[model samples]
Target chain A: MTGSAQPRQPEAGVRYDVFHTDCPARDVVDHVTSRWGVWVLISLRSNDLRFYELRESIQGISEKMLAQTLRALVQDGLVWREVEPATPPQVTYGLTEFGRDIGEPLTELFDRITQRLSPRNAG
Target chain B: MTGSAQPRQPEAGVRYDVFHTDCPARDVVDHVTSRWGVWVLISLRSNDLRFYELRESIQGISEKMLAQTLRALVQDGLVWREVEPATPPQVTYGLTEFGRDIGEPLTELFDRITQRLSPRNAG
Candidate 1:
């Protein structure tokens, strides 16, 4: 692994090193793996959800934080937002194709933790 | 989805809910996905690494944080610590069988982000 903090060149336009420190990919990981990011993505599943539905799904999350999490996911291109014209404009969020690609692996990782390796069983 | 904040019972001694907020699995997720946890696990990459080697591989991490991170992994059973009987009792850290199970999916999720979903390409 290279030690330099310079931005890494993508491998055939296909990869970046998260270890490089200067890679934008590292930033993306940091954001997605943030405290609420994974929860939001995994909570989304295959269905688009209104903000309140998402808030209710992931208990103890404040509306401010939920909105922030959705915003970051959208900016990462892993999620999309839509506004429904109703009595009150309803904003909904769902995983984009790219989101599902990454979310698939994230879900797998989560299952590994909650299923096979948590303290109760792995011990 | 259950909105109750009670500790979730594992399914057939194998599953726990991370979204329930009261599940121990949630705390584990919060720890493992912290700024350095995923990096450390992915950095191990099927090899035993001396403390300094790990620090070197992951640029910009301080010794205190690395030590703390290793301690957590060791306690979680995802990493094992070995003291090589030597002049200074050299130490090494490596993943346990369980760590490998979880690390596999984490690495896949990471690869998805860097390889297929980074802004430069996902756009």
Candidate 2:
């Protein structure tokens, strides 16, 4: 709750259609559904992580790419960044309420792939 | 069924970790979760369509992208193509069993976005 970025509040009666060519939600979907985005969101599902922890968990994301991804997610209001006041200034990243709402279905989709589709591939 | 592309069959005992850098499932996730891919899959959920029909239904997809997306989906065994014997050889595309299985959760996610998320944005 300290120095949190201002999240975008949905304007009343502003509907978006992802199927439409110009819908803003398309960008939202694209960001959350991006390969790196999915990995980052799901990795944070268990616990908030330091930047290095997120990098380690996702395996192959470049520092530049991870930073860019985090910036996009924070802008979308799906993830929040917290900077702790300290000698070195600790930082942690976690989902916002909106992030968790979208994360529910996203994680479910991820689970469908890993838990069912993948196991089916296994002998 | 004539002239349909050979779909990849999942081999038993071969596990895939989408979280891993090199897992084939990562490709699968990337494709299906793509902005256009999600629209294509969900469009076909109600009924199969011809190539042009798919392009028209997806709103802003260029012919190249729609064609390319279908080719990838068919190769992954998530979709199948049928060529009917006729003077012009009519063609149609539909989800295979695997496509439908994968599409189930994918559609659920789409619904979560369109039905729930979008409505929340509305006044």
Candidate 3:
């Protein structure tokens, strides 16, 4: 915030500004790039899911961590969190347009890195 | 390891195969996505440096963590570790071709995410 790095209001609706130290961008990076963040992005890549469904698919994430990661993603506008006023409170989580766009590239990167680093090459 | 998820052999130089769960890819992901891994990648974006130089650029990393992270990246073939046969044995680290290629896109993504999530728009 102290620096001259002004926030970018790209394309009217989208904004990206991380140069400043105090920007909320740092928080978003911390949340989205967190240990659970990468997995959450990959999990949500295929389809939408309810709270519990997401919890189950991610394998090792605790409910608290999942919820926290989701909330952070929502705040960053990278994820959509919908709440239905149905009988039992049915909620679904899915990727926003921005989040969806990131899927292909991120997935490709993940796939490549994982593939190249397989254990057999350790020797 | 039980499945037929054999590792890939590409270009007689590069390999990538991530469908398997037990592959070393998982370990690489764990290391690179660690709290410090992302920063280390970004730090290495600039140039090669001595061990201490890398340790200083990353701000809050402990010496142990830096060494560990570098070792992991080196093991994955994404980084090269050079040791000098001098009096005190000077060492330098730099990215491999694969690592360098990943920089542009990864840095672009990091910059965008960091910029967009700045706190001013958090409301």
The two-chain DockQ for each candidate, comma-separated, is 0.44, 0.29, 0.30
Q: Indicate the DockQ of the complex predicted as candidate 2.
A: 0.29
Residue A28 in candidate 2, Cα distance off native in Å: 0.9
Give the TM-score of chain B in candidate 2.
Answer: 0.78
TM-score of each: 0.82, 0.79, 0.73
Taken over the whole model, the C-alpha lDDT of each candidate is 0.81, 0.76, 0.69
User: What lDDT does model 2 reach?
Assistant: 0.76
Q: Show model 3 residue runs off by greater than 4 Å.
A: A1-24, A115-123, B1-23, B115-123
- lDDT tens per residue, model 3, B26-104: 5566666667766677778899889998887765678999988898888866789999999999999988876765555
lDDT of 3: 0.69
User: Could you give the candidate ranking by TM-score, starting with the highest?
Assistant: 1, 2, 3
Give residue A120's error in model 2 in angstroms. Answer: 5.3
Sort by DockQ, best first. Answer: 1, 3, 2
Question: First chain of model 2: TM-score?
Answer: 0.80
Looking at model 3 chain A, report the run of 10 residues with the lowest lDDT sum. A12-21
lDDT, candidate 3, A11-114, per-residue tens:
44333433233444556656666778777787889999899998886666789999988988888778899999999999899999767765655676676675
The TM-score measured for candidate 3 stands at 0.73
**Model 3: how large is the Cα RMSD against the reference?**
6.2
